[model samples]
Target: MNRRLSFSLILAAALSACARQPQLDDPVARGQRDFQGLGCIKCHQIGGEGHAWGPDLTLVGFRKQPAWLDLWLKNPHAWNAKTIMPNFNLRDDTRADLVAYLSAQKGQAWTVYPWRTAQAKALPSVERGKLIFNMAGCVACHGQDGFGGYPNNNVVGGLIPSLTNVSDGYGRADLHAKIQYGQISSPADPSKPKPLIYMPKWGDQLKPDEIDAVGDYLFSLKPKPAPGSAAASDDF
Candidate 1:
């Protein structure tokens, strides 16, 4: 009886393994698998899945040249001297498959975060800020912690600012302006031109109070020193 049960378990495991196997004939499927394996999902979004630290690659094929992409993927620093993108050290075959997968991505709307509607009010918790950051789709560029230095795939020569220590200088009003209007850049400087406005205007998307909640959340990201730490002293 024990032997029969063991055989049944073995058969189930074998079937499961077969079911998990990807289709080898499909280049798209192979490419998707390779993309995930290379940890591209850590900072990129394809078809509304994965992280949003980089540009939405859903329409990458439409925006970027395949040749440019091949070179960019191999070494991002070659194109942008200050780009934070890292080389994956991928082999030729893997890079080819990954590029094929990225090139197949076409115009698709970003996935609406599940908790967007639920986050209408500002809750006084850093944890809530973290949730709104992701649910509001802020994590795609600013990251889950509000630190935003990730290389953008769509905007080749744009600047992405970090929000981790924003509260150190900017007051709540400044935060309100920046968050609701995407006003990080100075309008006085024509050379800057308000920084290409990569971030969407939260004023249109969220209510004033809701925007305030997000602002509060962003302002709270300053690291608190441990008890008895010298940095914790109020005096300089």
Candidate 2:
């Protein structure tokens, strides 16, 4: 009887240990569990869930490169000192797992994202363009209304160019082409790594009409000079 009781106790202890171990068979699954367990939901939203305090991550996979995302997760402050996101001091493996999970969020899980909703579609072209700009994650790098002060490593000026004066340089057709094909920002110093924040091509992703609407919205932001002013005369 004494031997039997000792054996039973040992078995129970083994089972308890097994229960304590996290099932990490799948990295994406583990990452998802960590995403929820680590309170990321408190600040970031995914697929219409969680708080809106941070940028919606539904289309992050499409908008950002995996390497950039990994670096950002490791230390957000290193990239943006003013960013409100806190450092979790996550381990390398944990960060990789999280990246895997986040990279899987390509906006297909939901039937329709907020930007493609009926209400959004009903808005005027310029208004709808504004909505697409924000919801499609252009605002992540360009800032609101293309104010554009975001940093890009190895890029000229050390910041993304603002679109407030795009009209000065680009015609409607030219702007549309730029948006469709996108462009790689060359490094200021050839010796350094390429800029991680180059624009992504939207031709395959956005419709032709949507592209035109974005151009309209951008042109509308052109700084209007005072009537009959010197700046106004330069428009000719």
Q: Which candidate is the best by lDDT?
A: 2
Residues 61-131 of candidate 2 have per-residue lDDT tens digits of 88788899999999999998878899999999999999988988887756786657888778888998887
* Off by more than 4 A, model 2: 1-24, 227-236
Clashing residue pair totals per candidate (backbone < 3 A): 2, 0
- What TM-score does prediction 1 earn? 0.45
Give the lDDT of residue 117 in candidate 1.
42
Find the 10 residues in a row with the least total lDDT in model 2: 107-116
How close is each model in CA RMSD to the real structure?
A: 9.8, 6.7
User: What lDDT is reached at residue 40 by model 2?
Assistant: 92
Candidate 1 off by > 4 Å: 1-113, 116-125, 152-159, 184-197, 231-236
